[model samples]
Target: MTADRDLGSEARQMLAERTADLQAAEAANEALRRANAELRASRAALAASEARLRLALGAARMANWEWDPIADVVTGSEGREALYGRPPGSMRSAPEVLAAVHPEDRERCAATIRRAMERMPGEEEFDAVEFRVLHPDGSIRWLRSQGRITDRDPLTGRALRAAGVTFDITQRREAETRYRVLFDASPFAVIVIDQATFRILDVNTRACRDYGYSREEFLSLLITDIDVLGDEAAIRARGRAHKTGERTQEFEAVHRTRDGALRDVLVRVEGLDLGNGRVTYGAHIDITARKAAEVELRRSEERLRVALEAGGLGAWELDFSRRRTRWDARLAAILGRERVDAEVANEVLSRCLEPADLPAVQEAFRQAMATGGDFAAEFRILRPDGEHRWVRCWGRLLPDQHPGHRRMAGVVADVTEHRQAEERQLLFMREMDHRAKNILAVVQAALRLTPRHDADSYAAMVEGRVSALARAHTLLAENRWTGADLAALLRAELQPFLTAAPEAPEATRILLEGPALTVAPQSTQALGMALHELATNAMKYGALSTAGGHVALGWEVTGEALRLRWEERGGPPLAGPPPASGFGTRVIEATLERQLGGTVRRDWRPEGLVVEAMLPIGTIRAR
Candidate 1:
């Protein structure tokens, strides 16, 4: 019974141990199942992270690459082929990758990789390089690669593997090329300067030419060195302003060239942020010629002012469209108007013109406007004080820069004195012509009327009459041909024929009596001839035949007539009127009656012949 009980216990104990082992096995199976689920979740998370990294790399135009130095192999992500301008899976080895690099950059890239692979202990294994790659389309592209040794040989401590990223830098390189092209192609001088040190960093082709400096020389100079004023403080202030967000600054400054010649320039400074630091781009526009022209223009205007003032010239402008007239103070004075700054209405100027001159002036202006030609006009103006003045204007059309806009500018002057002088000269010419004709007519008449009984006597008579005319002309000329004094005329005609008596001088030989009256030029000629004939008769046969003889010529103005009597005494007496057809008597009658509108009568007196004449004052006297 003890043996059987021990066998049951052993069997139950064995069964419990088996049950424990099965439970432990079930527990281990559950743990294995849980671990499998966690491994699957971790794998999914890892896959999602890798996908994000690839997506990021693709978006950034970058690709992951690995280079194996020992095996001479190169491996890259999916987009690495495109970055290298190659077909998919074409770049498989280091030699192929090196062949893809540009011929100009292949050697440099090989050297860089070799150095990176031979890196020593405690030294950086980082490798970075920028190079050009050959594109399949016969174009070159820029690329940047950065990597480090991922694995190294323990014994040699040398690089065994490297991994990095490559990206497309073609766009950035092309942009830099375009910037350089524009920088050198500018017309105005362009200079690049370091903001902090005020040092000249670079210069364009124009800057080199304009400043008379070579490219090397320009690069060695400071910005302050070219400033003629050398105001370093001001330059620093401007730089500071630019650094503080001022995008642009402009000013006028004088700059010196390499030859030490100063130039006037308009400088425009623009701030550039080149990632490293702030720099300034200065564009200098030379304005030296413009400044000189402005100065010359001012001087020319001043010279014109002086000339105008000296010449007594008055400037005027007429705006046809606006119907307004503008004039300087000098012109206002000439027009007898108060000086005003504002333009006057055309009607105001027209009102100042004489009625007879307005039409002419208007027509001249109209023709000038119509033809776009020169304008010239001379007219009379009635001043406020009722004084008449003559004015002249000269003008020409202004340039026609704008179509349909007509303008003329010119000068005006008071020409009253000049006009008067011209009129005087004309009148003098006419008067001289008339006088010459009249004198010739008189001389011809005398020559025809003189008797030809003897050649000597006829010639003498003609000469005497001509002498009388010349004497009268002399008196007229002395009075500017306006008129001849009556008394002076009588004296000139009779003075040569007078002779002194025993007790009396030549002054008493003949008598002339008249008031201070002047005879018209025409009347003087006629009257002079008559007086000469009478005096010749007197000296030959009348009172003046003897030394003691005397003649009295007297006149008095009455009503509208001048009554004169020529009385002779103490010499030959006149028997009754001799032949009425004598040359001397005919001449006196013709002159006093036909020419002078007067009556001539002779009274035969016992003492001497007495002559009386009644002359119309209007016909003989000067007005």
Candidate 2:
């Protein structure tokens, strides 16, 4: 029985142990199943992550690549061939990849790769290169590659593999080229400067030419160096203000060139934010000529002002389209009106004009406007003070490119003095005509009244009378037909008799005493004829017939009449008045009494002859 009980115990122990083994096996199987499920889940997550990476690379125009130096082969993502402008699998080998590189860049690319593969200890195994690739279609593409050694031989320390990313940079490069072209081709001088330092960073071709500096030289200068004022601190402050939008971008400043020539420039600045810092782009436009023109224009205007003031000219303008009239202060003074900003109505101007002159002035302006010609008018204007003035105006149309917008500008001047002079001249001419007629009538009367003796004697008498009248007429004309001087008339009529006695001086032969008085034109003629007759008779038969004879002619104003006397001495005696009424005696009496309204008397004295006359002052004196 003990032997049998021990056997059961052993069996049970073995069974329990087997049961424990079985349970452990089942637990091990469950762990294996959970591990498998976790792995599958991890794989799916990894695949999705890879898909996201590929999508990002594609969007960025990038491709992952691997290079095997030992095998001389290359591999990459699906679109890696496109970056090199090649078909899929065409650039699988290193040599094929090299052949696709542009001839200009192949050697450089190979050198870069060789350098990266030979990286020494303690040195970075990374490399970057930008190169071009040419395609079969005669097109080229630009690419950038960045890589690091992925695997290397431990003993040889040589690169076995490299991996990196490549991307298309053609668009970026083309944009840079276009910007460069435009920058160099700008018409206005352009410069790029660093905002912080005010240093010139870059300059275009125009900037170099305008500043009289080379591109390299300009790049070395500070912006303040070109400022003629050279206020560095203020300029820097302004630049800071511009960056902060505290000041306007455009300003005028004088800039100096390399040759020290100053230019008036209008500068316009634009701020560019380049992430690293702010830079300024400046454009300079030279306005030196325009500034000079403005100065000259001001000088010209000043000169015009001076000339107008000196000439007593009033400037005026009329704008027909706007119905506005503008005039300078002088014009307002001329029109006797208070100052106004602009004359708005034609009626206002018309009120200052004489009613009779307004129509003609209006017609002149109308004709000028119709023909686009000049306007000129002379008219009488009534001032506010009730003073009448004559004025002349001249105007011309201003040139205009647009129709119906004509403007006329001109000058006006007061011509009252000129008009008065013209009227006086006309009156004087008429007076001269009347005087000539009177003179002709007197000559006719003398010819008719003279007696007819022998033909030669009669002609001589007529010529003598006519000559006397001519002398009187000449004296009247000299005085503008106003009057003749009495002393001058006496001297002229007695000149022949006084000079006939050459042995005796004129003072010894003749005496003239009279106060200076202007005789009327009519009285001068009558007295001149009477004196001629008496002097002729004296020469022929009285005092002048002898050399020792003398004559005294004198006049004085007494009350309202003038009394004149003629006396001859030291000559053969005149027995009495002529025996009969003679032509010379009658001429003297008729001229003095009938023409001058005066009385004449003769005395026959033993020594010589005497004559006396009395006339009303009104008839003898010049009025």
Candidate 3:
């Protein structure tokens, strides 16, 4: 049984060995099948990945690329080949790539590639760069390359190859350049600033020129640094408005220049949401001249005020648009107003003028405005308190002076006292002239009644005659009589002398020549008495002794003299010197001497007696 068992065991052992070998072979076959399945899956995935990559490159207008740094081999995509004006698979080495790159940028591209390779192996970083490529056809192409280190040796941890993509970006680069140029050369001043800090982020050339700050200097500064408004409150308010996303419209503000000058600017500010916070974009329009004009206007107003005060004159303005009148304090006071309302109308101002004088005042004002002429009006004002006072108003026109606005303003004055004083002075001068004439007439009359003597007596006689003449003047002035007629004066003075010669009046020859002339009171009294004495003497001895005898008496002002002449022809022979100087002769001599300041000569000739008197032209009377 052992032998048979041994034999059976041996057979079983051999069978078992065979079964084990078969099982082992089957297991190995199953392992190979699993490896084959995995290989097939990997191959499928790789094909799909390659297809997807190709589709993506085509969609982006790009081509795939590779580089073997260790071998200095370069492989480019179809797009890269096209960029170099060559067919696909044309680039075979780094030297070829260098040839394709522009000569100016070739070395720089190599350097950049070297730097990329040095850092690539462990976890390559994606990088992008731009360079110009030259083609065999002599054309230049702009290219953008995006790449990463894909094939690296794990053991050495070194980049063996790099994979990237290339695209033709010539048109895009040109567009970018044009946009930059336009932004730089724009006319409006543009500036970008960080909203929170108000720090300048960017500024255009126009902004730099307008603000008088360089780009570097402006970027370092805050908006407040350039804002000329020194008030901190206003700056803070503007900052708050910026943060609230409000679109600031045009606003006028002052800006400080590099030279420390102030500039007026109109600013438009807009907020930009940059994902982190807000930034401000501003456009500035310089209006410095306008601001200066405003300041000048204010100064002009101040000057006007000073002028009015210095001239002691009042000022007034009328605004037709506002329907108001602005009357200065002095002008209101002249109208007896305690409280003045500038809002009053023209009618109210006119009411202050006297009613009877209103038409003249209105006419003057109308003419002044119509012709743009200087205005002057004198009128009485009816004060609020019922007192009537004179006022003189003067004005000048200012036309087309206010730009974009119509306005007129001028000064007025209260000249009542001045006008009144002038009138009073004229009246006083006239009275003085009358008084002086009266005094001269009185002296002439007083002199005519005195006796002839030496220079001293003559002076005394002239004075006394003047006194008597003054008395006569007083009578004339009492009646306001200007003068006496020739007939009236003769009749009044010769009445006493003619008492006995009533019938023999014709015997006396008194021949008066020339036109009748009137004489004032003093002249009449003095000359009348002298003439009466001469007539009486003629009647007694000179020419009136015989009816046939005749006497001639004539008076005239010829050239420069008041002359009187008396001649007798048929009377008794010429008489010798008188026994004494009679009152009549003295009166005649004094009359000629004092009143006419003249010489009288009496001569006794063979035929008759002749008397002639000559007076100065200055003392001659005017009719």
Candidate 4:
């Protein structure tokens, strides 16, 4: 029984050991399966990465290639063969690929490879070359080749193979060529400046001519050397302000040339971040002519402003497209606006127009727009100060080729003062006509009262009286019918009858004296005519017939009355009185009594004849 129990125990121990061994084998197999799965995943990822790289190369118009130095085998990616316009993997060896290399670059390419191979193992090994390739279609392409020795012989010290990347850099090369052309041949002056030192880096041909400097001279100088027209600090500040962003900025500045001439230029600055350093590219456009034109335009505007102000004028523009109105400073002044930048609109102007005048204004605008007719309309505007003013607008159509919306521009002026003056003129004309008729009536009466028995006497007297009336009319005209200066009137009336000098009096001449006064227009003619009749009597028979004869005429203002005395001395002494008051006597009596509302009484003295007149001062206004 003890032996049987021991055998069972041994069998069970063996079974457990076998079971442990089986479990170990299963764990091992499980680990192997996981590792296989990971390997497959890694391979798939690598393939995907290579495909992505090729896609990237194609997108960039690039290629990748490899070469064996000993066997001279050429292998490349699909993108690599497309660089030379060939099928992928078509080339058999390095020489087969070299067949596409430009004849001039092939030898150099071979020499560069040989040199790279001669380097020692473990030495910094690299090969970089640029060469052109000829395609089957005969088109040329540029390629950039870069490589390094990947395998070398241990015993012979020979280059076995190289691992490299080659790319079709034709687009990049073409871009570089275009950049060079633009930099060298730009029309506006282009200057490249180093940001840190403000030193000139390069300049285009136009820059050299514009600045009056050679390329070498420009490159050697700093920005401060050329921007000589303004303060250096200011120019630097402007540049710094513009440099805050990479966007292109424009500014106007005066720059100095090599010959120290100042020139106005419009400068456009662009910031370039080239990774290694920052550079500023400036394009300078000569705007001296434009600046001069601007200055002249300002001067012209100033003159126009002065003229507009002086002429009480304002300028206006109606932009039909915008349904807006624009006005200048003069217009603002006319509108009584305080600000020059006052806003103007069609609605605002329309509201300013008087209700009655609006129709006329609208009709004028319509006519101008439809028929391109000259526009002249007078309207009334209520000023901001609540004063109404008359304004006349004159407009013309603006010539334009645009098919839609007409434009009219013109001037407006305040014609209030002019209108007032015109009214005054009309009043004066009517008064003149009335006064002229009255004088003609007085002349007719004088003629009728004259003696017809002596025809010659009548004619002589009429001529003389008419001449006196004409002289009075002349005085009124020169005074603008405002009033006649009393002294001036006397001088004018007696000028022809008297000698040149008044201080040196002559016999047979009339000498008159009076205080300075202004006679009313109404009284000037009457008083002038009265003086005429008295002087004519003295000339024919009284004091003025001989050189020794003389007349002394004087007047004085005495308490609401003008007492004037016309006295003759040393004349063919006047007989008592004219037989029957002659035409001259009637003229004197009618003018003084009826026209001036005064009386004329005569005092015939033995020495000469004295005519004393008493005139009411109330009729003659003093200015």
Candidate 5:
């Protein structure tokens, strides 16, 4: 029984050991199954991800390419080959791909790749550098190449693979070229500035040449340097406009040139927000010459105004369409009215004219307008002070280019002094001629009255009288036949003999008195000769002989006649009124009779000599 029991125990132990081993084996098998299932799932997921990547690449028209620098082999999508302008399967080697690169850009592309490999072996890199490639059809297209370093082979010290996307940007590049041609060739000067730095970013050839600066130099300058406002104001304003997206309009200001000279310019500034930041564009038009011309025209107008005022001429303009009349300040002042209300029309202006003169003035204006020619009229204006003044109106009507807006403009001048002078000249000519005839008759009479044996004395007296008459005419001519002052006349004709010698006359010997008055031309001539004759006689033998002798001269204007009284006191003795009919005495009588149309009396009194003359006021008034 013990042997049997021992055998069973040995069998059971072996069976248990076998069972444990089986369980361990099953566990190991189950774990292996799970790992196999996980591996399958991972493979499926990877396949799905690759499919999605291909779809995305196709949708985006993007091509993936790999380049192995060591093996010189390139692997890429069909689209990549298309972008490279190469035949399908043609870019299997680096050399094959490089063969399509433009000759001009081959060096640049090689250099960029070399630098990228040295800097970043297994890291990604990208660049938008422009490159050219030969098309499959023998044409050339511009392209923007982009790439990444995918892997590096450690054993070869070379690129294992580089992945990149290349897009055909030929149309974009062509459009840019077309736009650049237009932008550079525009007539208007255009500039673009970086808002942040206020630095000039881009300028065309015209802008550079206009500013007298080179393109590189212009890009280095700040916007404020050439800005119309200049300095900080320009910077601040440009910043504000850029931030607000505002479009500035024409503003007149000055800009500084490269040489620091200021030029008047009209500027229009605009802001462009380009998502990344801001840019400012400006257009400039030089207005310096136009401004100078406007200034010169204003100065010329001012000079003309000064000349008109100095000449005392009044200017006016009439607007026929509006029935309005415009007058300058001087014109208003001449008409004795305030300047502000001077633009009134014909109604008010007509009231300023005399009743008879108003008709003549209206006729003149009508004729001027009808003929489009010059018209002149002399008329009288009734002043506010109840006085009449002679006015000469001269005008020229200009034909209007506008159908209904013809007008007349002209000047008005006061001709009172001029008219009076004309009248005086006419009267003096007639009177002087009449006096010459009368004087000749007197000479004839004197010659007849003198004895035949006294021919020499008679000739002397006639000659002296004619010379005195001539002297009077010379004095009248100096005054333009207008008039002569009494004091000036006396001094001119008598002062020479009164102070002929160094000895001064007695204090009481000469007397002269009168208020300031203008004597007529006729009166001047007549009185001048009479006074000259009297002075000559007095210096010869009358009141001027000694210190005790005295002469008195007085004159008065009374209505129609001017009365003159000459008295002599304490002469050499009592002079009996020029006992002989000498030249001096005859001249005095003739002047008073003919020129003055008055009488002269000579008194031979025991008390020296006395002479008095009375003349008509009208005759003297013509002076």
Candidate 6:
């Protein structure tokens, strides 16, 4: 039994050993498969990385190169060979590559190369340098070369061979230069401000000059400090508004300079999004003169509106170059037509002109154009309603020096009412002249009525009476003979006596007072004569002949009647009433009673004389 157990155990052990061998072999095969897969993945990764590198180089139009210090040879890739203007591998040595450097840049390039080769400990691994290189086509290109040591001396830590990339940076440099030129030379002021602090970040050349600040000084200031119209809080608000918004804004603001002068500017602000925060780009354009002009224009327009309305005028302009006419709305109304457009063709306006006066109008226009002169004429224009209306036309030529291209600006007025008024005035003058002639004839007849036996007294009376009539006529003429101010009439008649003492104040020696009363032309002469008689009596024998004597004459209106009183004082006494009416008294009674349609009454007092007159107010014509 021991022998059988031993043999079975040995068989089991043998089978276990064989199974373990097979498992080891399977483990080895799986490990080998994994290694193969890893190798393939690494190859794929390297290919992808190389492809990416090639794509980057192509995008940047850059070239890779290797320089060997020992061999003194410079090797370039297919792309670098193209930059050198040669076929691949045409450049054989470092000196050949260096030969392509521009003469002005060759030394600098060599110095850079030497410095890079002498890399010191703790220095940056990468170095970048820029230089100009002359291509085979005789064109110079700005090249930027960046490199690090690919092979170095172990003991000295010095670069033995270097590998780097080169790119044609000509376009970039040109773009940078163009930006600088535009930013520095623009006419309008430009500014950049930081969004968070509202502090000025940058300013252009114009900004420096316009704000009266140096570039360094301006950059140190907050935006609000330069704003004459706003404070810090407002500037902060403006900054906030620009930061969170995408739309641009335009505003008017007053900017103050370092010299404390204020300038009106129109500012246009827009957001500039950057990595740090929102930056504000602002443009300031001056509009001070334009603002003043606009204000003046508004005031002038207002004045023109008032004048047109007050004088019943209409403004017109003709642009001869375009043969276009423009007129105010009032022009159409004055022509008795529907309001026309402010601008219209010339023929449309010329259609209204009358042929009789058209020649004068045309001549005026021609003269203005030829001589750059003023045009003025009275013409007639028929309205659409078929009524002829007289119009006074006036104009002036603009662009005075250039007659060929000019505008005719003018005023037009309807003169029908004025012309009719003038005609009426002429007719009235003729009537007044006829009436004056009749008055003279009446005076001649009255002179014949005077007693010839008292020749000296008759001549004196005739002269005084004629003068009184003449005085009345003058007063009426002064008013254009419309009527006379009753007060003025009395003053005129009493002028000789009232001012007899020039040293005395006016109207004090012989005081006169009355309500404003304008007597009609028919009554003015008669009333003036009556007052003259009374004044003559006072001067000859009554109040005016004595010192400290006066005559008080006054009138008031009541119940459509004028109650007037004349009181003489401080003069010779009247012992009794006149035995009968004298020439002067008779003249006063006749003139006042018949011509003025009034009555006169005389009272004989002990110390002086008093006269009361009743005149109808309706006849006096108080206007």
Steric collisions counted per model: 0, 0, 3, 1, 4, 0
Give candidate 4's total backbone clashes.
1
lDDT of 2 by residue, 107-169 (tens): 998898888877874565569988998867878888988898888788987878889999989
TM-scores of the models, in the order given: 0.53, 0.56, 0.50, 0.63, 0.70, 0.62
Whole-model lDDT, model 6: 0.82
Tell me the tens digit of each residue's lDDT in model 5 across 193-220: 8867888888877777678889899988
Q: What pairs collide in candidate 2?
A: none
For candidate 2, give the lDDT of residue 154: 86
What lDDT does each candidate get? 0.86, 0.85, 0.71, 0.81, 0.75, 0.82
Instruction: Give the range of the ten consecutive residues with the poorest summed lDDT in model 6.
Output: 238-247
Residue pairs in collision within model 6: none
Q: Which stretches of candidate 5 lie over 4 Å from their true place?
A: 1-60, 76-78, 118-125, 138-140, 148-163, 212-214, 224-230, 233-245, 253-263, 288-453, 499-515, 529-533, 536-541, 545-570, 575-623
Model 6, residue 150: displacement in angstroms?
Answer: 8.6
User: What TM value does model 5 have?
Assistant: 0.70
Model 4 has an lDDT value of 0.81
RMSD of each: 12.7, 11.0, 19.2, 10.3, 6.5, 7.9
Residue 99's lDDT in candidate 4? 74
lDDT of 2: 0.85
Highest-scoring model, TM-score: 5
Candidate with best lDDT = 1
Residue 320 displacement in candidate 1 (angstroms): 3.3
Superior candidate under lDDT, 1 versus 3: 1
4 or 5: which has the higher lDDT?
4
Error of 1 at 24 (Å): 7.8
